[model samples]
Target chain A: MRNVFGKIINTKMLYEYVSLQRLLFLLSLCLSCLYALAGFTIVATLNYIGEDIYGYLFLIFGICFLLTGISSIKINKKKSVRILIFSLILFLIVFVSTAYPSSVGLQDYGLSASLTYNMIFSIGLIIFGLIGALLSLGALFNFKPLGNQYGAYFLLVVCMLIILYPLVIIIGQVTINGAPGITWEFLTSDVRGLGESGGILPAIVGTLLLMFIMFVIAVPLGIGAAIYLEEYAGGHFMVRVIKMAVSILRGVPSIVFGLFALAFFVPIFGISFLTGGLVLSFYALPMIIRSSAEALKSIPQGLREGSLALGATKWQTIRRVVLPPSLPGIITGVVLGIGEAAGETAPLLFVSTLIIKMPPNLLGMVASLPTHLYTLFGMRGGLGDEVEVAARMQNAWSTALILLTIILILNVVALVIREKFRKEF
Target chain B: MKKKLSKEHIIQGIFLLIASFSIFIIFFIFFFLFKEAIPAFIEVGGDIFSTDFSNELGLGGAIRGSLIVTGGALLIAYPLGIGGGIFLSEVASVWIRRILKPIIEVLAGIPSVVYGFIGAIILVPFLTDSFRMISGFSLLAGGLIIGVMTLPIIISISDDSLKSVPREIKEASLALGATPWQTIKKVTFPAASSGIFAGATLGVGKALGETMAVLMVVSAITRAPDSWFDIFESGPVLTSLIAGHWGEAYGLKVNVLFAAGVFLFIIVSVMSIISEIMQYRIEKKFKGG
Candidate 1:
């Protein structure tokens, strides 16, 4: 066989003779076909298996492999041959390691065990199969089979799809399941019949109230911190310390905030809206400081200098010039922070009550959306009457839908505001 | 004019006080957690590091569980997220980037409880049916859900890092006749290593500290796994231990949960410090350039 970079061999001279690339490609293709066949057999025979779906998959893959292998034999490029060989070896190793089954019996291990084994084996096959396919397609890039740059763009499209497919699936599932539960009554009524019949009224009110309290407490403090770090502190040592502190605070787990609140705040303030909001404010404070600081920092130095040259004092320039442009950014930050505080469950678990009734006062324990959803889906252990479980599931989906919608809207508003201000400056 | 000057002074003073409040709160957290945890520290002594879950007060199992979940989550998240980030920064068009960026932000914005809810309703059942495990809740389920939860953080940070790699270096590599992939692997990735590491550190802190989703999907079994790396088995992580027991915990149990919180706080703090340093270096590099 010629070297990988060698000129293409004349097809007429090599009808019987296979180059190294063709041989390796054919071998890998055959192995993958066998793997797919095995999957088809198992999937078809399993009692709960979805028809002979895998059988058809195996047939289609087998045909593709044979066709590719035949086409590869006629080509004689050296670089294509090298990549094909490497991909084959990698695929062979993956197939061998993953498809080999253990000696555990079906009876002893149970159906789930075998099902897991098959699922993993199938996944390995599919991954290796794709890698081999992509490697073969790499030849097209070398040959310029398609227009120049098309191959590159094709790979980019594939990568983009790979990232997007999972997100699409999750969003689709949530929307389909949750949309039914969202109604006017669902939005406005108190939860009743143990979350089976009542609307999510109390949870909605509680979530909004908690967000309001958190906004009241966190915005001023966060904006102050940002102003200090950005405009006042410069490169001072204390600024560095505060920056470090903010990063650490940001990294602290939401659950830890809950634990801290339970240990420190509950004893002082008791389990109420105040405690929940305070804990959530702590959870959101670092985010607010960081985003607001970024917004403040992005203001051009020329603007500040321009104000100074106009005989305005530093405070006057900041108040009149800097703060105006940066207000939108700060509001964006605050809105995002409130969105975060609204979704947090762990921090509020100790401070917020699961009471379905409306909170009588700020200090009264209140039902918030996230904690309420957690109670319905998580605290139940998923073991109950079938009807009850189904009802709870519907409620959980609706609650999740509402929560997701609120967050996405907040994020969209923030994005729009940031982009608008960003373009203006 | 004197009164106006004093007014400005007063406003600045108020802002300074407000800015300093967070630092005070941090100190307060440390003091309070330590004060509550000291008793458990004394009780468990070296046993706190044990992986044995049989002991009611020993935190070893919880610690091990936290490590397993965090490590498992990173194993799943790092490659996919980094790859996605690379694609977003290097391969995607401006339009694609614009569309995908907000999707990531939306992913990040989705509440943790919703993630847990999805896991409880969807992922748990799938795991049970696919694996035929008696209980659907397992370390694997928790890891998968938390991995998804952390993906936005990893992708956003890594994308920023990759974007920060100077355009000239990429052009230089291309000029040298390297393939786009080759240039990315050799030049762009190396240039962005510090930032990527910072992103991974941040991801690790997130996975380690995640509570609600893991609690919802993984059975809060406060036991060491049947094996050291049994992702199929149920276990209790540090965060879950606190979340599960805190409501009903009394006396030593409460202190132990606080002790676990302190342990988690320290780990997260170290990660936060490392990421902060890396970020500072990146900022300095850009400023100098």
Candidate 2:
């Protein structure tokens, strides 16, 4: 009797574990079915039914599938998985056979001209159905109870894919569309006829010049401020206030900075590169200070004390000892700031202009890569000519590709520098 | 010795002044925005809040639009970003974190204009087809693009906060026969709540102030939404209004734009202050002060 009781308890435990796994399996199955139904409806309506009949047919089909799956799971029968898989396969076969061009039934449905459209629809349905079927099959085949360990891995992979997929698509699309337009001549000549012809030479030069001016102005001030905050200020209330101010600056919208520059700098400087650069400097300052301060804070206190003990002055220690070690970090911050300033459009919009011809000097209006792209994008209906709009779009994509490439390179280089110097401490 | 001391004092003084420059600029921004914005406020008086669409300088519609877009963006960004953050700090292996960290940083580094461009070219058409909206440029499009743009900020900051949670508490929870998820839910998340709040506030501030992406995708319709909850309709946000009008704005119109900027500045500043205080409190609590 005791042996029989032990066997019953063991069976009960096994039953509970199986039930839990079934629940999780059903959840993923439901999600996959919903996803498939949505995809199917989108493809069908967008391609054939003209978006008016969306969600009706698919909703009905999805509800039916959900009901069938739920009832099957509730029955605690081993053949439910086989039944689900069989139905999915049967549906796939029917979908393809009906959607195919050579099928004799096509004439009856009046979908002969939409052979390609039906094929696309079938593809979406097949993809989602296969995923759901496979996940369910895995759950069915496994007798041992699945644990949270596997669930954790599943969640991680899904989330990572969710984050990475969009990046991949954007980069892929930009490259495929833009690479043909990135010829040497396209990079060298000045834009003419409102970005319909010629190259982005002036925009490239102007972007470089603006970055140079911004660096010259922002780097010293940012570094000095970082130094004071890290070394001289201690934990004073004034220091706290300064930190708050920097956070506030960081939080201020880039557009407001543009407006402030328009209100303050443009009238004084008359909408020149100087005004643009000064505003960009304000934008870069908080990043520079925060990054440089973090770098300085990471330097060992023992090293500072060691230098002081050896009779080196505080300035000497900072310049010779602290600064050298923190140089990579500071440079990383500067590169990041440069990348940010280079990509900025709003701050430069009012303070700069879209000059097809290059500016004669810093005080004159200039073209920039971002502003040039903005101009090209905004050239849609205004150009009136379809060919001109197409050309402008091609140029805009190429410019975007170049801008993204430059920023990516800067980031990679910063990462490399940080890794190289990080091991030293 | 005297010469050395004098030189050091001078250097300190110069550095101090340089450090104070940011603070000076903050006040200067306030002064400039208000100097121009106040005149418009006084001129428009009660008309500033007018719901009339014909009133080009009305703040009511723009304010409501900003709230709707920002709120929608927060709704999308907070859960995904915080979940990603939790995964990064707790679940991801060191090698995976190394690969993923740079990706997140690079995503963050991508300019707002590029996001806008992508949104205009890709997201707008997709939304139009899928949702069957007459026009694709709507609050939903703006919110989505901003949400994507705000993800990196939320993830990076929240990850930092979650990483700051002491390991001992997590270990203790695990030792008490709790699962990893349970430990994270019960101990790590609560301990890191303030930091997460700070990150969320920063994300809200970002979405609130995002101009170019919204300006590029969202139609600049300066009117009240058809319904309070209708995110599918095109509307004018404050930042977009400032950006859209900045090109042709003159005299009173320009001041009104500045008034919009001033409003943005105030809202953003309050959020920033709150985030800063939250961060401070977190630090203090972690330090056992």
TM-score of chain A of each: 0.78, 0.73
Q: Taking the tens digit of each residue's C-alpha lDDT, what string does model 2 give over B1-289?
A: 9999999899889999999999999999999999999888888888887655345468888888899999888887787788788889888889989989989888888888888998899888866655556678989889988888888888888799899888889999989878787677779988888889986888999999998899899967677675657777788898888887676777888888898899999999999999998888778888984
- Is model 1 an incorrect, acceptable, medium or high docking prediction? medium
Q: Go through the candidates in order and give each one's C-alpha lDDT.
A: 0.76, 0.78
TM-score of 2: 0.85
TM-score (second chain) of model 2? 0.97
Report clashes for each candidate as comma-separated counts: 4, 0
Q: Give the deviation of candidate 2 from the true structure as CA RMSD.
A: 7.1
List, residue by residue over B1-289, the lDDT tens digit for candidate 1.
8898898788778777888877887887888889999998998787777776446577888888888888888887887788788888988889988988988887788788887777777778777766766778888888888888888888888899999888988999999877677777789988887889976898999999999998888867777675656677788899998898776778777888899999999999999999899889888987798
Residue B234, candidate 1: Cα error in Å is 0.1
lDDT (Cα, tens digit) per residue for candidate 2, span A71-103: 556434554555465446545544554444431
